[model samples]
Target: MNEAISLEAVSKVYGKGRGAVAALREVSVGLPEGGFTAIMGPSGSGKSTFLHCAAGLDRPSSGRVRLGGTDLAELSETKLTELRRERAGFVFQAFNLVSSLTVAQNITLPLRLAGKRADARRLAAIVERVGLTERTGHRPGQLSGGQQQRVAIARALIADPEVIFADEPTGALDTMTAREVLGLLRETVDALGQTIVMVTHDPVAASYADAVLFLADGRVVDTMTGPTAAGVADRMIRLGAWAK
Candidate 1:
């Protein structure tokens, strides 16, 4: 399979000299096209840093991040911004929605911001797929946490991006709500060919992924494939990843 996102020996450091701290060290990962992947690691194990650098939210201190065929290191700030906006989609624990906009408007916000016309059928279909068709007329504040996240997923999907980065999407959700959201995310990959890289600590959540990349310190220490929740937990434990 072709790579959608590839991090080549990437490294990120904060501060300088004696005061400097290494966030990621010689980290390399490949997210396959149309693949749903989970990245699991301890709190300070460079999971966020890796995602930020890989997503072009922050530049790596060294090495390269390739999204599709373009090398992010070669782009100017403006160009990088355009590339991120046009080619990437993000979903995080935070809603990051505009409170003033209706759900339909929020879902099509990216297209609107880029001065492109939103396709009515596509928008309507995606909203339905995410189970948000009934909530389209309402604003985020009028919805529950689960409903809000469904909108966020719909918004990310409306763009039809090459890669979707979801950073702990279920972190702020309750158990039942988390399962619903996660199931929808997995459904997107299976039914719509959506490529996703999700950062999560929960073994049950990671089980939904096609492949799980286990990170220790700043490096990929192991990988589990076609995993069940118990299988993933066993592998993570053996890799010395924190269980609780």
Candidate 2:
């Protein structure tokens, strides 16, 4: 299977000398193409740090991070930025859409930033796929939380990115809205064959993934395939016990 992202013994440290904190330690994992993988752990488990490093938003202090087989450490800063913009997509819990831009405009923003024009057909299809065809003229303020997230998802897809990194995507939404958004993400993996690495604290949200990776104290301690919410919850409880 093709690897959408690979990390080989990656580690991230913040600060210096005795005060330095290890956010991640000797972490290595690969996200296979066309898979939906969720990262979950208790607070301070380096879930966010892992996502940032894997997505090229943060550089590892040691080891290698490769996005679609390209080693990020080898690239210049400009090239790394370009690679992330063109090859990677990001979704955050905040649904970071421009308030003034219409839905259509927001969705196309990434392509514009990349100095590329959108294909009219593909753009329309993306809008339709995300169930926002009629709301293209509406601004983010006019949309519901779920609708806003759908816009974010469409924006991520505008570039046809090889990998998508979502950081607690449904964290801010209501239970119903979160479920809808998670369903859309799951569908993207099944229907569009998109590879997604989502970091979430919610067991229900993690259950939407094809597999779930568990982190504890800056290390990956376990992984579960075809995880159910109950199963993930049980594992999380065990991790909590270990922490205590």
Candidate 3:
């Protein structure tokens, strides 16, 4: 399978000299096209730093991050911004929706930002797929937490991006709501062949992923495939002890 995202000896450091901190240490990994990966680690384990560097939200101090075989280090700031806007999708824990816009507008925000219009059929299908058809005219304030997350997922999918990056997507929802949102994400990968890389801490949440990459002190220490919730919890227990 083609590599959707690849990190080659990537390292990220902040500050300088004795004050400098290395958040990622020559980390290297490849995410296959259409694969779903969950990144997990204990507090201060560099999980967030890894995601930020990998997604181009922050640059690596050294090495390379490639998306679709193009090195991010080689792109100009303008080109990188354009690439992210056109080629990637993001779902955040906060939902990041514009309070002034309706659901439909929010879902199509990316297309509009590019000075393009949404494709009617595709937009309709996405709305229906995410179960947001009846809520299109509603504002975020009027919706429940679960409904709002569904809108966020729809917005992520409307762009038809090569990959989706989710940061604690279910962190704000109730258990039932979280389950529904996770199910939708899984369906997106299994049915639509979408690639997703998520940063999460919940064992149940990680269980939904095809594989989990466990990080510690800015390095990948272990990987678990075909994960189950109980198995993930057991592994995380070991990681917590290592964090000491």
Candidate 4:
């Protein structure tokens, strides 16, 4: 398993001196290429912060984060932005599509910004894969919540990024919709060999990943493999996350 993401003794602190607040502390983890991983933690447990640092969306104050063998900490802001565009993809609970843009436009916007053209054939194939082929011309406001999320997923895949980072990808959906979206994410990893690192609090969501990392108080506290919703719940329970 070649490493796609590597973090070494990473620490992130907000503010300075006596007013400083430690957000992450000496955290480290390795994500195998072409693998799917889920991160779980209670609120303010550093799950989102860790994901941001690992994906180069945020920098750790004192540590190293590498994506696809390139040191993210060493890159300049422009270079870091380029690296993210070239090698990393991002998804969030909220569908951040432009209300006026059609599904096709939303999907190809990144390509247009990168000054690269989106191949018509490739765009059509991806649209079909996301079950949005028939809705390509519809604006985001005209789509269902589930369909909006599908568009987001398609947009993330359009760049053929080395890794996709999702923060609460299922947080805003209903149970059925969440399950459907989770299935799609898992399908992409299993069928497309997409490397995904998802930050989720739900055990059901964690079950979709090949592995799960549990964080607490800004540190990785445990990990589990062959993940099942039950197994993930037990780990969270042990961490007092599932209890009052």
Candidate 5:
């Protein structure tokens, strides 16, 4: 399968000289074009740093990050920003919706930001796909946590992006709501062939993915396929993630 994102010996450093801290250490991984991959690690394991670099939100201090065929290191800030806006989508734990905007507005915000118009048919389809068609006129403040996340997911899907990067997407939800959200994510992969790379700490959340990549001390330590919640929890235990 083709890779949606590829990292080759990528490393990120903060500060300089004696004060320099390495957040990522020659990390290399590739996300398949139509796969759902979860990233897990102990606290301070560079999960956020890895996500930032891979998503082109932050540049690697050394090595390369390729999003599809484009090398991120080769793009200027303006070009990179444009590329990210056009090709990638993001979801976060907080939902990150504009409080003043209605659900429809929030979902189409990315198109507006890119100076593109939203197709009425596409908008309706995406809204319906996320099971938020009835709530399109409601503002974020009026929606429940799960409903708000559905809005976020709809927003991510609006662009038909090559990859969606989610950071603790279900972190704030209750177990049942989280399952619903996870099911939606799974549907996107299986039904829409959407590629997703999610950074999560929850074992159950990780189990929703096609595969799980484990990180430790700024490096890839292991990987598990056909993961189960129980299995992931055990692996995290062995990695000493729970102790911290």
Candidate 6:
């Protein structure tokens, strides 16, 4: 399979000399196209830093990160911004929706920002796919957490990006709602052949992924395929993520 994202000897450091902190150390991984992968680790384990580098949201201090065939390190800031806007999509724990805009408007915000018109047929399909057709006319404040997330998902899908990077996407929802949202994410990978890389702390949430990359001490320590919630929790325990 083609790689949607690849990192080679990527490292990130926050400061200089004695005051420096290393977030990622010689991290290298390739996320396969059309695959769903979850990144998990103890707090302070560099999960967020890894995601930012892989998605071109931040530059690695050394080594290379490639989105498809484009080398992120080679891009100018303006070029990187354009690449991110055109090729990548993001979903955050916080549903970063405009408060006053209706769901449809919010979903089409990216297109608007890019000075491109939203294709009506494609917008309708994305909204229906996310099961938010009925809520498109409503503002974010009027929707439940799950519905708001669905809108976020719809917005991510609108651009048909090569990959979607989601950070703790279901962290704000209740169990049942989180399940629904996760199921929707799974369906997108299965049905639409979407590539998703998500960072989640919850084992149940990680179970939705095809594989889990476990990070500890700024490096990938292990990987588990066909992960289950119990199995993932056990692995975390072994990693000392739950140590008292």
> Taking the tens digit of each residue's C-alpha lDDT, what string does model 1 give over 1-244?
9999999999999999999988889988889999999998776778888889989999999999999899999999999888877788889998789999999999999988888889999998998998887899999999999999999999888879988999999999999999999999999999989999999989999999999888877788778889789988887777663424
Instruction: Please say which candidate is ahead in TM-score: 3 or 4.
Output: 3
Q: Poorest 10 consecutive residues of model 5 by lDDT? A: 235-244
TM per candidate: 0.96, 0.99, 0.99, 0.97, 0.98, 0.98
Clashes per candidate, residues 3 or more apart or on different chains: 0, 0, 0, 0, 0, 0
For candidate 3, write residues 20-137 as lDDT tens digits: 9999999999999999999999987899998887788889999999999789999998898888888899899999999999999999999999889999999999999999889899
lDDT-superior candidate, 2 or 3: 2
Task: Report the CA-based lDDT of candidate 6 relative to the real structure.
Answer: 0.94
Q: How many backbone clashes does candidate 3 have?
A: 0
Cα-lDDT of candidate 2: 0.95
Instruction: Compose the digit string of candidate 6's lDDT tens values, residues 5-96.
Output: 99999999999999999999999999999999999999899999999999999999999999999999999999998888889888999999
Alpha-carbon RMSD, each predicted model = 1.7, 0.7, 0.7, 1.4, 1.3, 1.2
Query: Which stretches in model 1 have alpha-carbon errors above 4 Å?
Result: 240-244
* Range of the 10 consecutive residues with the lowest summed lDDT in candidate 2: 235-244
Which residues of candidate 5, in runs, are more than 4 Å off? Answer: 241-244
lDDT of 5 by residue, 1-244 (tens): 9999999999999999999999899999999999999999899888999999999999999999999999999999999999888899999999999999999999999999999999999999999999988999999999999999999999999999999999999999999999999999999999999999999999999999999999888898899999999999999999974336
RMSD of 5: 1.3
State residue 126's C-alpha deviation in candidate 3, in Å.
0.2
Residue-level lDDT of model 4, residues 87-186, one tens digit each, is 8888899989999889999998888888999999999988988899999999999998999999999999999999999999999999999999999998
Screening candidate 3 with a backbone cut-off below 3 angstroms (N, C-alpha, C), the clashing residue pairs are: none
lDDT of 1: 0.90
lDDT of the candidates, in the order given = 0.90, 0.95, 0.93, 0.91, 0.95, 0.94
